[model samples]
Target chain A: MDAIFKDFGKAYAEFDGYNLAKTLAPVAPEAQPDRLYNFHRSTNFSSVQKDFKSKILHNNALPFKLTSEESNGWVEVYCAYWKAVGEILNAEAATKTHNKVSWGKVYEAWKEMTVVLIRGYTNSGFQAWTVPCLYVAGKYMRVFAIKADEDAANNPSSAINFQDDFNPEAEKNEKLEDAARQLNRMFQICLSDRAPLEESRKWGIYNIINLLFKTYFKLGSVSLSKNILKALQAYRGDMPPLDNFPLSHQVTFKYYVGVICFLEENYVEAEKHLTEAWHLCHKDAVRNKELILTYLIPCHLLTTHTLPTLALLSPYPRLQDLFLPLSRCIKKGDLSGFDAALIAGEDEFVKRRIYLTLERGRDIALRNLLRKVFIAGGVEEAKEPNAPPVRRTRIPVAEFGAAISIGSKETMDNDEVECLLANMIYKLVLFGAFGLRRRIYRLHMKVCLAQPYPPPIRRDFSGGTTSRT
Target chain B: MSAAPQSGSAPTTNATSSDKNADPAKDTKPAAALEEDDEFEDFPVENWTQDDTEVPGDNTHLWEESWDDDDTSEDFSAQLKEELKKVEASKKR
Candidate 1:
């Protein structure tokens, strides 16, 4: 215990934030036999305090000495850390004994620790290093809050009084909500830092923002993520280039931003961000890579009429099952097959908030079918003498109607087929030129003669002719 | 091309033809198993460059042109011919 304080004191005096964080973190269960945190075994706050004071503050034999001012801040932070660890110990004991109340106590203790740690951000020499400490405090605070909330829901009689005055309107998950608010305070502290780049609290920005993103996403309050992005954008000029940040920060930031754009139907921007995240992502991060590809693959399908190859999907079996059927259906221009695949993956896609985007692939299938129809038309001699013959691009509407009926589950009347054709023409004009000339379908060869039909460009399907740029 | 509205009259034939032609089992699997850990976490690595990526080169091998040029193969061509013959026969009727 004395050596633990000595090392902590040395790190503190040297302004080594990273080591301070390591020292401050609660000892993991597997490391219980280690003497450094053997004090944790005592499970009493005052006794630990007695040890901290006698071992470091009152002992003149210690190599590092703290001034009175530094001693005051150190004592305060130490007390907060000890209280949090004590509550955690209590929570663990409670878990063994199935005591619900101790979870709430743990949450409250960590909440207090977060508040105390925020003060270090304003301390001149300690500002830069406070981030790691705050991260630990904030993360566990949320974790325990979630546990507390679950306990409250499961055993309402033991619900902790989260506020001084109870309001009848207190919503469920109030504990988690309060934890989010505390995290927001930490976010603000980092954002408002006016210090120079070297020791600025601004360095903590992405880490805090990432935490907020996780929270917002879990709460299903996706719109709130946009506010964080707005705030970051407002501070962009003052902040360092994102590329200069840590890779974890960069990848996490881009993933959230990409998913946000994806939800907003901004496939182009979403693809750009998600692709960067995927490319720069760590090789061993299989789960994260799968998550990135979860959104990235749909964005790829929409923005560029492309599907992930079997090799890409092979590594991720979940992605393979979710995407392979859809890609095969689209490639074959099999409308009924596409519908079946979409319906089969509907639940997972909807859970990922991508059902609507994947639903748009039906248009591509229809376009491919139309492309095949044009090819089947073969070539026709030009009416004018000496003019090179052109691929037969003009055909009756019934030909398309037949292909449509052949691809779909039910045979459609001419009217329904025409409506489907008109809709496809409006959405996919760039794929091939189609004109309904007196009930005859004219597939214009001029726009793409060599490649008679290209992939359709992404367009807005929400009741407007305005194409997506 | 058949001008007759055969599709409207023989709905069963069209339905069965599409069902036989569009086999959905070639590459697909059962619905994907639910994802276990959906939440994103910070990567273990704080910083890395392209050297650290799983795949070394440009990701050309990962994505391919979606259009299948061989779509005009025997089966699809045969199906198209049958459908066109149906249209022409109906028009003559």
Candidate 2:
């Protein structure tokens, strides 16, 4: 057994070293000065793949083959898969010329090669390595496809000849979607107990799941994303510790889940996840940290009525630009200012799809308005001596309307005011409803009055909150 | 293209913690799955711009910066003013 393991290790190192040398080898200095050199290298790659298959294919004695033993054969498979794909990426980066080797043909071959490599790795149960490799490779494919599409769209050459109006990006999108679906299938395989879930492999699942979410987001397939989140949640028991993932994956996963929940208007859960992501993210990952906070600040406004402090927004200038005006309006109950800020930021918000989420901030403004009326209505005398004075309740809906009208340039009617109040009640920003009609709810002002700010997240759950699978 | 009323979310319902624990596998029936049309019912944005992924993660500044150039803000503000006017007009009616 010891000898077999040793032999596997030796074979893996030899295979990997040879591929690295082959991939890195500079084009022979002067062998082919013409463009035909690309063809020569392509032929060389085919011969190398053939030699690789003859040596490593169907070797029953390879370590970690059928039984649960360490096998060096996995590395050779990994290196070969990477070397094949790496050649294309490296060559693309080597020159400024686009489509020198015909992207259409290369992508078709890669589509085939990805399937074979994935199938072979899965059969051997070497998921830990294979999943991460595939995750990154999948990301590169998505990025490259997008870059190609952009190039095709912007390349002046295409503009010169309007007759060939074929859209290459349409094909690229289909290929990317196909690749995403394939990765999802492989992820399902990795979820089983038979695949090795060693520490490193455990972290790889986060990367795979995150990339899957990105793909779904890009596809704008919300139902598919929802299904994937549900699937991941159901398999929660099998996942590793949340701390095991790299900070980027942890933050990215929580951000997506939080944004999804916010879209569904599940404010409480969104607050929980976004808060955790904000605090746990690496402080140096400035942009990501800022992105998490952008969603988080709005979640806090909705759930707790707490505004972000100047101190909090100081470190992130971009976030401050996004949230400061909105927060100030929510604080002062400036309805017009809030609307103006939202409109000013409309394109940015719509692009991020946070317009709907932040639109809910209007509730904060309304809450502040109602609270002002409560304060101005004055406190009635306490029932007993040495008791705190209770604020007056049951202020007329007409009075709230007048307060709302002050924030607007146009006059507001009683029914418009009632409609606004009804919405407030429906959203649960206010409690106790005795009537709904021409009249708004008769309030049990105590519920609205009792220091309505939400408590801060407890320390125990802040940094260590595990995602629902 | 069917002119369904844009805002279709049935007023906010309390999100129960049970949603956290419900096993999704047991409820895999396709009919029960949330439909695309249903989810987008409350989506207020009429026109979605193309991919916002200029930079990998921090595209907020990209949108803001791009809109600053070439009157995007003015266009969106006009659209917003028009929508607000419709709401006001509806309430008056």
Candidate 3:
């Protein structure tokens, strides 16, 4: 115990954050015999407090003596750390025995520990290093909150009473929501710090933001994630460049920002962020890469009217299954096949919140079919010698109707086919040319004659013109 | 077409297309069955350099510019011929 205090005192005096965090962290059950194991076993709070005071405060070997105020902060933090650890161990033992009631105790202990740690954040020379300790406390607070919520939901008596005072606006996971509030306080602390960069709490901002991102996403409150981004944007100049942060922080920030843009249907911005995340992401992180690609592939299809090649998807079998058939049908201009593929992957697409975006790919398929029609209309011969031969731009409406009927299941009347053409023109899948009333669909001469006719499919579902070529 | 499938409510043309190829088993399965496996994972190491990532270069091989293949025009033209013939026959009937 004396040695443990000696090490803690040494780390605290030197502001050695990593080592300080080590002292606070609970020992794993599998760790071999060590002096730290004795600290872990010291479940009596009063005795532990006695040892901390006698060994750490009085010991002359620490090289520097802590001020009374500093020693008070340390005493509080040290005692709270062990108290939370003890409750966590109790909770684990209870979990082994399927004792659900003890979970709330773990959450309470961690909540208190987090408060103590937050107070400790204001202590001079401890602000930067103690961020990890706050993270651990907040993380477990949310975890145990979830466990407690699940236990309450599963318990019959609790469920029976849950309906009595249930308000639709009330949080279903009260404890978890409280954890988010506490995390927000930490976020505020980090953001409001005006200290020099070397010792500023600002360094902790992304870590807290990442934790908030996880919490809000788990709570299905994605809009709150936007608030975090907006706050970061407000402080953009004060904050360090994203690249200066750890790779983990950069990759995680980009990935979440990308997904948020994705959910908002901002495909272009989403593509930019998700692509950066993909490039910066660790090569060994196959799952993270796959996740980035999950949103990225759809963004690519929507923004650039492109498809992922088999080689691009070979590494991710699940994505291949989700996207391959859809890509194939779009390329072939097979309307029925596209519809079938969409239906088959509907659940997965909706789960990913990308069903609407992928639905727009049908326009691309129709555009390809229309492109084939223009290509089949080979160039008409030039009337005079030395004149350029003009590519055919005008085709009988019946030709398009024929193509549509062949691609779909049933034959359509001319009026129905014309309506479909009108929709395609509006979508910019087929560049609108005048003469629909005459039953001859005149394609835009320049657009249709371009090598890849009808231009790339540019769809703007936001009711804006698809002016992007 | 007389047998128009269900018309969708959205402005985008949800033409009543045939579902002969759609697998009922696939459609009927609950959405939750397709578990989201690509969740964000914590990094094993807190920091690394660009060297730890994939060597960035041309990304063209992954994305194809145009959906068309070499044989697409020929196949489409031949199919259009057959379909135009069918349309002509239907008009005559």
User: In model 3, which runs have C-alpha deviations exceeding 4 angstroms?
Assistant: A1-16, A26-38, A98-101, A123-125, A156-159, A162-165, A168-171, A376-392, A406-410, A432-434, A437-469, B1-39, B73-81, B91-93
lDDT string, candidate 2, A371-425, tens digits: 6655555677888999999766655555566567654678777677767765665
The DockQ values of the predictions, listed in order, are: 0.22, 0.01, 0.23
TM-score (C-alpha, index-matched) for candidate 3: 0.80
Error of 3 at A435 (Å): 2.2
In the range A123-200, model 1's lDDT, one tens digit per residue, is 523447657777767666776777777767676665556676876335457788888898899888888888788778
For candidate 3, give the lDDT: 0.71
Candidate 1 scores an iRMS of 17.2
Q: What is the TM-score of chain B alone in each candidate?
A: 0.43, 0.23, 0.40
Give the whole-model CA lDDT for all candidates, comma-separated: 0.70, 0.53, 0.71
Per candidate, the number of residue pairs that clash is 5, 1, 0
DockQ for candidate 3: 0.23
* Native A-B contacts reproduced, model 1: 0.60
Residue pairs in steric clash, candidate 2? A63-A71
For candidate 3, the TM-score of chain A alone relative to the native chain A: 0.84
